[model samples]
Target chain A: MSDMRDMFVETASRLFRDYCTPDLLRAAAAGSFQTQLWDAMVEAGLTKAAVAEDAGGSGAELADALALLVPAGANAVPAPLAETLIAGFLLGEAGVVVPDAPLTIAIPRPGETLRAVRKGDGWLITGAVARVPYARFASGGVTVIAETAEGPLLAQVALADCKIAEAANLAHEPRDDVAFNEAPAQAAKLTTRQAADVYAMAAAARSAQMAGALQTVLQLSVQYALERSQFGKPLGKFQAIQHNLATLAGQAAAATAAADAAIAHAEHGAGSIAIASAKARAGEAASIACNIAHQVHGAIGFTAEHALHFSTQRLWSWRDEFGNDAFWELKLGDQAVAAGADGLWAMLTAAA
Target chain B: MEALSFAPPPVSEEAERVRAEVRAFLKTELANRPPFKKADSWNGADPAFSRKMGAKGWIAMTWPKQYGGHERSALERYVVLEEMLAAGAPVAAHWIADRQSGPLILKAGTEEQKQSILPRIAAGDCYFCIGMSEPDTGSDLASVRTKAVKADGGWVVNGTKVWTTGAHIAHYMILLCRTAEPTANRHEGLTQMLVDLKATDGVQINPIYDLAGQHHFNEVVFRDAFIPDSAVLGKPGDGWKQVTSELALERSGPERFLSSFTLLVELVRALGPDPSPAAKIAIGRLVAHIYTLRRLSRSVAGMLQRGDDPAIQAALVKDLGALVEQEIPEIARQLIAAEPDTKSTSDFVAVLAHTVLNAPSFSLRGGTREILRGMIARGLGLR
Candidate 1:
């Protein structure tokens, strides 16, 4: 199992490293699609990495497929790779045909809903979703879990048919405000439990990405401290700088462990508690790691020319994307409280 | 910088099975114990309870069976230790022996030493304390002034060791002292001697109470205490190598993070079924940290089992674990409005006072935060 994951990760890392250059990232942030990079990812069979072979994917285990995000995140790949992997799972499981082009997800925030009603044999999707990741580049479609009169159902709506207001996060990645005004869509029945699992998976993916990005932040800070000199000595020789990097390493280690635990749980069919903990822990790590990395690098890292921001900016944005630290902490805290004091240890041990 | 790897801990059915057994035992053993008393956890010594645990074959679990060990996997030992810690069991009597000293003996002891000491340790009839620090040495252990001079049948040690935990109740002390004159290389010419604290002549243990009025810490003055040649551990000049390995075992354990756990239990109990959003967020944050630290600590155990030197990784765990352990008290105070009082009747207040007073030592003991971070920086190739 570990060998298979190693092979898969090695392949994914090579592809991402070749295409996610500083020039490509800058162009993608400036309202241009990374066409060559996207084509390479599609040809490498990475777009549908997690789905079963029968369902138009490489038939790789979900854990191995999700492992690709770590390197992709390390390079700060400015694309909808994480979203596409998640979309593959949702669409393949709903028995819908996984598309060839880049796909995005319309996950509605709390107090918001996207509705789907019957329109002849097909369905029509209405309502709006704020911050639909990569909606502008999802040439295939936007996968959504829409509310129906009967129950919640899955829908794949064409991006061309919807209104997309281009928006960018801290890292300049596209997070569009997409509105579907009676857009024609392919629909399938989906349970409410599955819908909740989708949310958990999204949060888990963000955690993995944060874990990878934090590693880069640590590397950058350490390298800068060693190479950059002041007062006739490298900055790393100073106790203050060394201690700062040590703290950053600690945060990165915690996030990586948390993300690894989340992926393990996801593969084993135990998701909620682990995912919640991962998101909360990774979110906190992101905040601390970015602060230390920036402080160590000084003004050079703050400039656009340096590559440190490529990872730190994503960490800053991804941490708050799919339910920040406070959101998941509340969920986990509620579960712990409900279990009471006597049952608290039991709850943790049971999950293990 | 080399990337630090903390792979997922391997799962063992036997380990899980042992976890259930340990939990059941703790349930019965601690049924009548109150939170204030349980707060002592590994620091609370009880020889009778240690004997009971020894009878259960928990001590020396990973050692050879000939030395009264159970020959269990490292994962099984981890499960037992964590379960004991979570339930706040009094394990001070056998903790140091089972954790580092016995393992050290098994690694470097003479045949006679292992034959006599291992079984007693496994039986919980023997106890050991470390004699590494002195009045002039804390973090800089290589600069210890303690020295053992050559004698007729053994060596005579002379120097004072301070801040020695459990020295009063301990039967033996693993003394680190110079066997030769100091050279330019300070770490050289050092030896570790197994001094019989009670039987050895000229050894005086004076009590040094902590702020909480506890007698766990002590000052042992050795005025020419004699240790036999057979009591020498490994080579005479290998004390530096031996003690550092012993510390890796000491640094990355569940005890480092779970010292203030009893207070968390009381806080949860006081919060009841419903709590404010602030309280829930605070509690959830602590839980997330504990969950992550457990994975990191367990991964270090796996590395140790594989015979890898994870000294840098162990330092990182202790550095991070101590922070969360200390933070639990600060967060608990904010969530509820209760003044920390050691003499209070309320369980919450009493545990709070105990944890607040003890939190400072969490970072100080094992290794100071500054020292551990310096080691981490070295691992990162920055020092």
Candidate 2:
């Protein structure tokens, strides 16, 4: 186990240092998503790293997948690679014939209704899903739908079946509103509960990404503190900046640890306890990391020219992407209470 | 550098069985003990109970059997520590010697020292206290002015150690004092000596009552105290190295954080089935932080087992863990209404009282927040 963790640390460090350099992050922020980097990850088997080997990919565990994503996040890579990989894996896990291409899952907005009806050989998906991340770039999409008789279902629909309207999220990710009008779709074997489970897992993965991004921002901020001089010394020489960076480092470490633990639990079928915990911690940490990086960088971090904006912006977006910190917090608390006193004690003791 | 990744090592079957055994022990032996009471676990220090644990070979599970040690793996020891702390057992009596002093002596002490001390410590028949801090030198150990002069195969030590927990009851103290001349470097010429507490020759232990009127802490003065050269831990001038390594053990552990865990459990219980939104949020945040800290701490333990001293990482865990623990009381206060009178004997309320009283020491003990942050910043290369 120690070796595995060390391997993760080694892999993550290399990815961040060599691939997710400041220039690369800046390019990502400027919408110059590196196709070479994406392709390199794919060739390195990182894209479908969590999928079973039987499904034409490395059967890496969830932790391994998360380990890869952390660096992807720290670099603020603009491609929706994480989302695509997750959507593909879920579809493949459910025995769906995942297309040999990138896929993205669109989160259903409040008041949005997705209805599916049986057709001759497939189903017709009707309704609009809002805030679909990387919708325009996906070859297909995995969307949530409510069926009248069959209940909640996750269906895989080709991008050709839906219209992707150009949209920009707060963090400048290329999102879009996916509008489906009786589009032909194939229902995967995933139920509504399973879909919710998948959503939670995806949220956990995205949280890992956010954690990675936050860690990067922290490192960058620390580096800036060392390089930038104040009164006769590096800015880092000041206790105030030192304290700020320490706090940020603590938060980043906490978030990273939480995400890793969550992935471990999820892989072992531990349910929402782990996912909710990771999501909550990562969400909060990402927001704080962004704020701290900007604060430490001062005016330079806020400017468009600095690379810090790349990670900071991604931190803001990824935090809200999978579910905000508040949402996950509620989920975790409700789950704990539902487990009752004895259950809570058992869980705490087990963790301890 | 590879991508940032965290894949915990797999748990062994023996470790799993050990965890079960410890769990069973807690359920049976510690069933009646309140969770909050168990919060201190070993730090709660009841001599009789600690002696019982020693008898059961639970005190020094990982030590060599020849020296009254169990010679278990660090992971197995880790399991035991986690179980004991989770159950909130009274382990305070033997915690110090079992944790550091005994280990230090085993590694650096002469065969005679090990033969004399290890068995007693393993038996929980002896206790030890840290004698490092002075009135003027808080976090700055090199700034210590306590003097120890060589005198015919022995040393004459004279100094005052303040904020020493368990000083009143400890049988001995592992004192770090200046053994040579003060020089340009603050870390030069120091030594760790084991001083017997029962000696009335020139030592005085005075109680320093805390805000809660608790006498858990004391100030000990050693005037003309004689200590044989054999009493020194490691080589003379190795005190700085020994002390720094000891701090890693001190700062990183389940105890550094989770001090107020009993209250957190109580708060959840008090909330019942349906909790307010605010309460839910607070509890969720707390649990998340706890989970995160546990992983980080565990990883540090893994590092230690591999012969690595993760001082910076340990400091990071301690600083963050302390803050999370300190916040529990405040969050609990806002979540649950205060029962002014003794209307409720709920475990939650009792745990709250205990945590509120102890929270201040979370950051103060081991190392102050200011000192820890400085270390962390330096670790990050900020300074």
Candidate 3:
């Protein structure tokens, strides 16, 4: 990372540490968006951190911006910050002006065509969005891939124009279903990627988020082990608990490494295998890490009053959001099989 | 937050180039290698095969060129090591010397020792064995009672070293012996002595076969083995420090995770491209694990190359690696119904059999899981 990237990370870290408190997270979970937190992040230029400078935003490198997601997610900042960054990038690419409001992205299922035809002065959009993150709270708009008469295009459509049946994920954040029946869309940019690329992008982002959440839960578990005493000793002193925490640490490290691999490969072009590996590995890590953390925390972590669930619940939700372990496992395993025994080595080594 | 830092280190383009070359070489070299032999990974020795690697300057890769090394970067060496392990190359003949012992000599041995021994090690012709575990010592390495009394020129050693891998085949042993009486600190007064296995008069090497009847482990006893003044590695009392310093070098590597890689390759082969969703998920889990482990292992390599001590990180890699590795056979057991048989000609069954028998020792060697967890706990500031 360059000095500028380091500064960006430091600023984001300090901001989250100062503002993203447990109270803020709890309030955000209870159906209230944290405007002050989002405003602070926006003022810091982090909201448009993924957009191009020529498109009117902080033009941080893709990998650099993605890396910041780790610390942001680690802090449990309780906002649609990553969504806004991604949405802003997509909007900027289409020459659309990014709004001051918070943003969310809608991921379509694999191989379902989205159509937008010319209607009056605007475009008529027809698509069904499932598991749309922050759909109820995307104040700026939603970034979606739709098929127009001009072929596939990345377009920005407002939330108010679409019919949304709001839902929530395991973490209590919005995962609404949005139906765009001839909803007005504009400033669309042409794209070549399919639903798979969208899945990869979402997977990459979620993998980073999972890495951050797992790291925090590991810290929580370790802290709990150090404080909670039984049998005349701290839990950390017991070999069984120590081994469990050690295993947790290993899982956390693996998750972090997988995320890093995704970020690094994103530095190159179109990260396919790296994204698959990241999502699959990080999801597995999240499963192991979350289970061990809860086990280590005992009954304390099960309560809503405790903060461990803030991260663990988010991990549970995020692992399945973009593409779950089973979803990506087939993709990677299929690729590995097609690669054959001879091609497997090349695929593994090609990441370098 | 400051606990075990395993940030995936960046590899250079040079390392990637090295990877391509290594892969191409392995494709040609291992085209006809049997799956059973490949399943042994680093423990399967072939002197001729090792020499082939030596001819390519793949051994002692990160060492200085004067020591018969290729003068490659640590990341470059890492690429080579991982590619070999993944391909199940027979690297046992030079694995120890290239991975740890030669590096120890380079770090702490005298110039004369470096010139005399490191070149042979780098050449891949000279094999070395670890003499850390005594008959009474396993994870309690500090409890070693092997003693060497001060003599005319240097010392006369007498002790029994058990579970010494490759003792029957290795040319030299980096033996750790107590030079003085153990005080409150058992690690105190210990010394590392270079032993010539063939030339040593009082040494006896006896086979200690494992459950699978492999010949790697041995019990070597010395009655009155002579060590000259130049044979001492590092300072006498600093043996503990020296041995522990080289541990991260030994623990974190592709070998730790890639021991079961052949089984994975065979699993993939058996499943073909279109297995059931259950099989895909199972294999994908293993793929995810191996990929993550490889990244962690590479990060350790980067740290080692930068001359940093990543002991805690190495422990984490080894422990998690063993867990996933040991789990491979179990998972493969469910994914495929073939009965494991070492004598079977079927690649999948043979590799599965080989891995099932050896999986128990993954955590047992390179410090047990309990010990590694203890180290990790200390790293986390828990102890």
Candidate 4:
């Protein structure tokens, strides 16, 4: 294995083994307590992995840094890792100073729009950004704003600069809608396209996280099968259970490969096709694996006492975080056919 | 299970030249051949064409030159297979023999067997069939009831094997039979033997038509069929192990799921430009699936090259690849304006027709979807 994949496996395994317990997942989901796992991750320099060395980070490659977050999704470790790491990397790349605390970003719904107008010495942003993850805890946010003359622009605003209304999702991730009522903010150097690109990258990372969570759930289900016995032998020995695990393993493998490819593409400047492909595949695979894991684990998998739900729940949440399967599928389809048959052939063979 | 990190380094210029040479050979050979003809490639099973390939020293390319082989690298062999499949060559005649049986005998057969059989197989003058599946035993080889009782100098075999592809045309079969008394454990006491189809007495091969109305498969029954001790592959009780190893070869190839590739190419050609949104979406999803399957399949190949069984990985590929291939026809039906006609002369239409006809067997042939999922679960340590 490459050092990068090894790092990913090791980091992900640790979170599943140590912090992402059933109790921890329940606490995080119930909004009752914050798991210290987030602090531990930051202490381990995971959150700042993609941040530049100049910005008090390891300055690792964006893909490598993003890999660390996959396990977080698998374990459903409630933290601001995705938001903070991505925000930190973008800020660091643009020579902006990110706070020591975590940061996240939010976009308006697909049809909605946000506007940022120039005022006095700063920019005044007025819009509502929904489905913002880790908004309650993030110290700052990177918001997408559309300007009448400039097209689209990404701006960074402190949490104190905007109003946050707590929001809850089906998968138990913390979310909120942020309404900026003429909130003053500094303009990020990245253009709308750049911001979109960054968002796609983050979405790819989120997919990786979902992949990781699915893997964890698979592991848990397999473990359960071995210990849970019927008909004088463990269920793991049965062909039925074997087939389910095999399918899940394939799904997990697909998720990993797709996410890795996406990361590689992003690192090499391959553009949206790579990200779209990864997000789409990861979304589908994660959803399938999550459902299968719960099904295989049966009643236990659904209970709060079993840690399987911790990972599976996160898989469910992260798959929709950046871009859902439907969204990325359309994006990839448009680009692929638009490139024409020859273009599609080139892309397919080019990977070889 | 690990991500594919190291590429096989880079091929030398000479190696690249060799690949180009092979490509040139294929181009010349297939210039006048319709693209749809290439769709069946190896699976198309034309003996004459296979003989021509053998004449080019393509069959058993990795074997030593002394045994009618070219002593090429496995990677070189892989290139040939890929090119052949991509071009849709009719390689079925020598496919099994060249792929596994020849290789297996090379590894475990006696000097006499190698001298008599390997050369003929390399020449593509002889064909081989698998005698593993039985009426009682589907893919669960351990449950096989084909008895090969010990005799003075040989053995007497009696059993019925169903769904045996190319039985009527094959010269010999790699048979798995019960040699010893049935042990408490199902996988034990079985053996593999090379049965001569020409000399075997009381053996009947009956054609079994597939859904496509193709007589490509058969049910072969052996009654007191005799096989000398030398014909045995490896030792008794090794059949289970050997067959399991053989599956890595059987399941890992591009053929496991590429059966629908011709249809995909045809669909693209038929759709042309400015495809409807629905068509584009379907194609996009299919392409993504194909891409993912290729990567997974490549990883399995890498594992095999490194001397790893990767049975679980192979099963994973087969399950997913089958699904992807099976989905192609449905997607094509929705995307294209005209209904597929299997008997059509048009290359795209014909390939699509063939794929639609053959798609159901995709999940059923190698191992049923249910069977594969069970294996995957086991590999994941699930019950």
iRMSD values, candidates in order: 1.2, 3.1, 1.6, 3.7
TM for chain B in all models? 0.99, 0.94, 0.98, 0.92
* lDDT (Cα, tens digit) per residue for candidate 3, span B212-289: 988889999989888887889998888899989878888998889888888888888988868898887787677777
How does residue A316 of candidate 3 score in lDDT? Answer: 90
- Model 1 Cα displacement at B337 (Å)? 0.9
lDDT of 2 by residue, A1-352 (tens): 3454446546645655667666775665556556776676666566676677887766666666666677777767667767766766666666666554567886554466777787776778888877787787776565454454677667888788888887877667777889989887755443644445656777778877877777778878888888988789988889988888888888888788787766666543325666777888888887777778888898988887788777777777777876777777776677678876556646754653
> Which docking band does candidate 1 fall into?
medium
Q: Write the per-residue lDDT of candidate 2 for residues B1-383, one digit (tens) a residue.
A: 11122235335566668888777876888878866566556558799877887887787777888889988777777767766776687888888888888888887888888898889999989899999899998988888888999999989999999998898889989999999998887788998988889864789999999876677889999889889888888898888888888888888887877687777777788899999887787777777777777777777777777777678888888998899889988988888888522224667776777778778889988989989999888777665
User: Docking quality tier of candidate 4?
Assistant: acceptable
The candidates' DockQ values read: 0.75, 0.51, 0.65, 0.32
Q: What does candidate 3's lDDT look like per residue over A1-352, in tens digits? A: 6666788889998898899788988898899988898899889988888788887788887667777788888988788877777778667766788887888877677655567888776667788978788888887887787876676667788778878998999888888888988888855667775445765776787888888888899899999999999989999988888888888888888888888878656533234777778888888889989999999999989999999999999999898988888888887777778788667767776754
Least accurate 10 contiguous residues by lDDT in model 2 chain A: A187-196
What does candidate 4's lDDT look like per residue over A1-352, in tens digits? Answer: 3585567558655855597776777777888436377677777677788888888886778777777766676667677777777777767776787666777866555665678877776677888877788788776565443453566566787788888898877667778888888877765553544435656767777877876776677677777778888899887787766766677777888877777667666643325566677777887887788777887788877876766766766667677877777777776566666666435644554554
Q: Estimate each model's TM-score.
A: 0.98, 0.92, 0.97, 0.86
Please count the clashing residue pairs in each candidate, in the order shown. Answer: 0, 18, 1, 21
